[model samples]
Each structure stands twice: as structure tokens, then as C-alpha cells.
Target: MTRQNVSIVLIVVLGALLLAVPALAAALGNPALVGLATRVLIYAIAAASLNLVLGYGGMVSFGHAAFLGVGGYVVGILFHHFRFSEPLFGVIAGSDQLLVVLPAAVLITGILAAGIGALALRTSGVQFIMITLAFAQMLYFFFIALKTYGGDDGLVIRRRSALFDLDMRDDRTFFYVVLGFAVTFFAIYATVIRSRFGLLLGAIRQNESRVAAVGIAPYRYKLAAFVISGMGAGLAGALLANYQRFVSPDMLHWTKSGELMMMVILGGAGTLFGPLFGAAALISLETYLTQWTERWMLILGPVLILIVLFMRGGIAGLIDQLLRRLK
Candidate 1:
């Protein structure tokens, strides 16, 4: 099929799914599950952001979760210290004020990404990965040591940030906000992947030496991709803090970073929508499996191994292969 055809089909399918969400929620009669799905969508955005670096830029960052933690903590800390009642510089610091917090989270994450990428882009292969991981660990411990906002125990957001009186505390309202951001980020990512800079980054990923030989600086492109990825993760992190009404150092753990990478790989790296599918599938399976049995990880481990062993291209790649075979 042509790319246009695929795009149309995807748009149609996504529209249908979104339209059906309300009906589905009504049928299930469980607001909590709907809320859970919304959370998955937020993570999908984060995973897609990571894919910009890992899949396209050929930069393997083992500390992507730190961005999310940073975003969440920004929301938590600001509200806790700055008095959740009034706006800072005319903007509120609560969960309902997603507009205010989201940009702040993204900017902060971008700043950190720029600094970390400057050092990390100087290295390559396993060294780059280890350096990123170490930086994340350092931040994790810093948060742990912060005794002001519940520190190791985490801080609870007593109220949702305000957005023109829309109560974000309502599960349905929050779900729609997350869904909106997910779709918006997906569109932005698609545009970025097709832009000139994206093409250069793609080239660097395939052959850094050749890109450098052509007079293009591979490091700059990689750093740009890293900052973009960090911003995406930060957006998800801010939303997550609102969803959970808390922030903790655990969000910055290496395991969380690994999970982001796993989502990218499982969803078919380089595919725009792969991360969304992967996050939804993995998180859903985890949620259901944990409820079914105590040894959830035991079951999950084999499934992941099987996917790596047999489904080499992941779900999106598998779909592509099957479609080609049909043709």
C-alpha cells in the first residue's frame, strides 16, 4: 500500500477508536479502568519521545525516565513550596494547570538533556549508555535526599491544578486531556521525523562517519534529538504526577528507564505509532497478569523473550511484513 493509503487507514482507525472510548467506558461501568487506559496513553507519548533518540538518532539512553521524574517533581515541588493557591508569574502550580506545568516540565527536561547530551554525545556505544544511566542515578539519589517534600516517601498533590475551573480531579476530564496530548505529540513527532533535521539525524544513525564526512556534525543532530526526546518524556511525567497525585524518586529509577526502552523495541523502533501500541499492550498485559497471578514477572519474562526470539520486528514490523506477504 502507498504511504497515503496507510495514513488514511490509520487516521480512520484512530478516529473510530477515540469515538468509541466513551461508549466503551460506559459499557465497562468502571471509571477506574478508563482512567488506567488514559495513563497508558500518557506513557505511550513518553515512549514515542524516547524512540526519536533510540530508534532514529541511534542514541541509546538508559536514563530517559529521569526526564519524567524531573517533570513530575517540578509539579510536585512547585505546588508544595510555592503555595498551590496562587499562580506563579500569573500561572497556577497545581494539577489542573497542565498548561503552566507542562511547558515548565518540558523546558526543564530540555535544559537537563542539553547538558547531559553534551557530555554523553562525546562518548559512543556502551559508554554513552552507562554515562546516561549514571546521571539518572545521581538525580534519583538527589530526589531521595530532598527532605522537604516528603523526600523518599514522595509528595501527595492535595488538589488538581486548575484550567479555567475544569476539575481535573474528575477521571473522565483528565482522561480526555491526556488523550489530547497523546494525539498532539504524535502529530508533532510525525512532522519532526519528516523534517530536514530528522533526515540528517536518520543519516547519522545509519552512518555517523559518513554524515561527518559530508560536513554534517553528528553530535549536534544527536543532541537535538535527545532534547526533543527529553521534552516528550517530561510532558508525560507532568501528566502522570497529576494522575497519581504524587511524585517520588522511584520514577527516576533505572528500571523505569529500561521499561521505556522496552516499549520502543517491543513496538517496532522507528515506526511512529509503535511505541503507543507497545506501551498499551505491555501495560495492559502487566495489569491483567498481576491480577491473575502473583508470579506476573515470571510470565512476562517468557513473553518478552519470545517476542525477541521470534517476533524480531516487533508488532508494527510484524504487521508490515504480513501485509507485504498478503500483497
Candidate 2:
């Protein structure tokens, strides 16, 4: 089958599965599973953002989680101290209007990312990775040192951000909100990858010197991709904080960044939907395994090792290969 035909089939199957989830959850009466799925979707968005940089732009950042934390903290600080009443510089804080907050989060993250990416892209290889990681650690410690808003203990969001009188505190409402953002971001990502800039970014990823020779500045393209990636992560963070009604320093940790990378790798890094699949599988496994036994990491470690050894392209790649064989 043609790639377009395959994509259509995949979309149909995925849409059916998503639509069936709530019904299945209701039938099983497993609120936990429903919650887990929601969490998976949120993280999937974050991981997909990471893929834009690491998988598409060939930028291996070890501090992408910093953007997530930054976005979450922006919401938290605005709500906590601003009395959850007034806006920043006359705009109301905790507006919770996804339309308002989502764009704000993306713009904020994009600015931060542009600054960081400009500096980090000056170096490559381990240096680039280490610099990004170091910056992320700095942000993590900064949050830890901020005595206000619970510091290391974290800050609680007393209420969900308001969204047109929508009861965001309702689990089902929150779940749909997250799902909507994930879908929207994924759509945006798809468009980006097909755009002229995305083509240049892909060229830079494959051959920087060649792209430069063709008059395209590799650094500029890469930085742009990095900023877009950060914006996606930031949006995910905003949704996450609303979902949990809390924000913490751990969200900025290097380990969380690594986990995002792992999710992309496990899902088939370069493929559009790989990160989502990877996040769902990994989070689902972690949730189920932890419930089944305390030593969940023990099992997870070996499984990951095996996947790396035997499935280099990840689950998405494997499925694609299988489909090709059937054809």
C-alpha cells in the first residue's frame, strides 16, 4: 500500500481506539486505568515535542524538561501570589481558558528555548548535551531554592485554571482537555514536518555541511526546531499542572528529560506518532508493573535493554515493517 493509504488506515484505527477508551473504562469501572490513560496522553505530547528536536533536528538535549517546569511554574506562581484573581500586567491569572493559556505557554517557552538553543547549538556532540543538561539542572536547583511556593516540597494549585465555566476539576473534563491539546499539538507537529522549514531542518539533521553549502544556515533551522519543540513541551506542562493541581522541581530534573528521550526512542523516533505510542506503552507498563510489584524498575530495566538491543527502530518502526511484509 502507499504511505498515504497506510496513514489513513492508521488514523482510522487510532480514532476508533480513542473513542472506545471511555466506554471500556466505564464497563470495567476502572477509574485508575482511565486516569492512567490520561496521564499517558499528556506525557505523549511531551515526548512528541522531544522527538521534534532529538529525532528530527538531530539535537540531543538532556534538559528539555526545563521548559515543562517553566511552563508549569508560570501558571503556579501567577495563581498562587496573584490571588488567582488579577492577570499579569493587567491580564487575569489562572484564566484557564485553553485558548488563552495555551498560546501564552507556547510563546513563553519559545522565547526561553530560542535563548537556550542559540547558546547550546554553538557546540555539538557531548558538549551540546552536557550544556543543555547543565542548564536544566540550574533551573531545577533554582526552583528548589525558591523558598516561596513550597520550594522543594512543591506548590499546590488550589483550583483548576478556569475555562469558560467548565469544571476542569472534573476528571473526565481534565482528561478531554489533555486529549485535545495532545491532538492539536500532534496536528501542528505534522504540519511543521511537512513545511519548508521542516525540510531544511531534516536536511540539516542528515547533513549539516550539505545544508550549509546550499546557503541554508543549519544553526538557525535547528534553533527554530528547538524552540518549537520547547513550546510543545511547555503546553504539555501547563496541562499537566492543571491535571495534578500541583507543580514541583522534579518536573525540571534531568532524569525526566532522559525519560522523555527514552519514550521517543521506544516509539520510533523519526515517525510522527512514535512518541505517543511509546509514552502510552511505557507509562502503562510502569503503572501496571508498579501495582503488581514494588520492584517495577527491575522488570522495566531489562525490557528496555532488550528493546534497545533487538528493536532499534522501536515499536512504530516494527509495526511499519510488519505491515510492509503483509503488503
Candidate 3:
């Protein structure tokens, strides 16, 4: 089969498997399987968001997890006030409805991203990374200081966000709901990559001076992409908070940001579907390894190192190579 045909077959097979997950888990009597799959979808969305700036825009943000934390906290804090029938800041009312909550998370993160990008984008290379990381650390500590919202112990959401008639409490239902969002995001990202803006972003990554010489300011485009990427991370954060029913300062930590970066790099930084593959591979590896040994990170470290050392473009690249060889 040709490459296109092979890719198509692979996608269809992958989709089929995803659709069968809940049934398979039920048959195997392992409901945690659904949860694992749900987590992967959430991470995939977050990792894809990071790819927009990291992969296409050639930006390295060490503090991307701040967006995730912010998004989750938005949901958590809003609901906490709602449960008490108290308005947040004695102004905005808390909402349990998914429609209200998710959009709020996205909008808040977008604003945060815009402010951060406006300043961070002024520098280049390591300075930019450090500035982003600093912003993340600041947010992380800020959350930790919010003693009213469980502080270091974190906050538990008693219930999931309501979405009209949908029963999100059901594992299968929530998984499908998350799947719908993941698929929607993947479609949107794909569309973005095909648009003119995506083309310019790629050009900036390849050659910034040349693009600027042509009278296009790379800053505006980069900032725009950064804001959009943050919004995507925010959306994923909201979904993740809904799935886990908890939010904590750790969500905004540097380590969590590192994890998201690893997902993007491991899956093939610049490729579509790379983040999904990366999230699945990393999460699956962690899941299986932890089941076997407590020191899973020791094993994971070397494995990731080997892949980074030998694999040219990560898992997606490896697959492309195999397909070409088969052809």
C-alpha cells in the first residue's frame, strides 16, 4: 500500500480501538482502563497545545503547566463558591454548568498567556524559557497560598460539571465526552496548520530574519500563536479537572510542565497526531512500569534517553520510517 493508504488504515484502526476501549475494559473487569484512556486524551490535548508554540513557533516554554493549573483551578474555585452559594470575589457567581466553566477557563488562560507572551516574547532562547518558568513558579506559589481552596492539600470537587442532560458521573459517558473534545481539538489544530497563519509560523521557525525582512513582524504572529496555545492548554486543564475531580498547586508546577514538554518531544514535535501518540506512549509506559516497579522513573529516564539519542524524530518519525521501508 502507498503511504497515504497505510496512514488511512492506521487511523481507522486506531479509531476503532479507541471506540472499543470502554467495552474492552468492561469485559476485562478493569474500569481503571477507562480512566487511563481518559487521562491520555486529556494529556494529548494539552501536549498538542504545547506543540503549536514549541514545534511550529520554535518556542520553549518551561512553564506551560501553569495554564493547565489555571484552567483546573478555574473550574475548582468556581464550583467551590457555587456549592456554598457564594459569588467569587463577591461579584461573579460560581457555576456548575460545563458550558460556563470550560469557556471561563479558556478565556482566563488566554488572557494570562497574552500578558506573559507580551513580556516573554521580548527575549530569545534561554531568557524566554526562564521568564516563562518564572511566571509558572509565581502562579504555583500563588495557588499554594490560597488556603481557602485547600491550599497544599488541594481541593476535591464533589461533583462534575453538568452539561444539560449528560450524566458525566458515568465513566463511559465522561470518557466519550472527553474523546469528543480531543477529536474536536485535533481537527481544529489540523485546520490551523493548513491555514496561512500556520504557514507563517512555520516560516518563522525556519528563518525569522528572512520572514521579517519580507515586512512581516514575527512578534505579533508568535504572540497570537502563543495565546491560542495557552487557550488549548486551558481547555485541556478544564477537561482534566473534570475527569480527576481535584485541583492542586502541583498542577502548576515546573515538573508538570516538563511532562507536557516530554509528551510533545517524544511523539514528534512538529507532526500532527504526534502529541496524541506521545501522550499514549508515555502514559502507557508509566502505567505499566509502575505496576511492575516503584522505581519506574529510573527505567523511564534511560528509555527516554535512548529514544532521544537514537530516534531521529521520535515515535511518529519511527512509524514513518517503518512505513517507507514496507513500501
Candidates in order have lDDT scores of 0.85, 0.85, 0.94
Going through the candidates in the order shown, the clash numbers are 7, 2, 0
Best by TM-score: 3
Instruction: For candidate 3, write residues 5-124 as lDDT tens digits.
Output: 888899899889999999999999999999999999999999999999999889999989999999999999999999999998899999999999999999999999999999999997
Q: After superposition, how far is residue 183 of candidate 1 from its true place, in Å?
A: 1.2
**Tens-place lDDT digits, model 2, residues 1-327:** 787898899888996777667677888988676678788888898999999989888889999999999888877776675465655566555454556666777789889999999999999989999999999999899999988767999998887787777788778777777777778788888999989988787888899999989887788788889998998899888888877889999999898998898899999988899998999888988878988999988988888899889898898998988888888
Candidate 3 wrongly placed segments (more than 4 Å): none
TM-score of 2: 0.94
lDDT of 1 by residue, 106-178 (tens): 8999999999889988999999999999999999999999886678999887776666777777888877778
Candidate 1 ranges with C-alpha deviation above 4 Å: 1-3, 84-96
Ranking by lDDT: 3, 1, 2
Candidate scoring better on TM-score of 1 and 3: 3
TM, every model: 0.94, 0.94, 0.97
Q: Which residue segments of model 2 deviate by more than 4 Å?
A: 82-96
lDDT (Cα) of model 2: 0.85
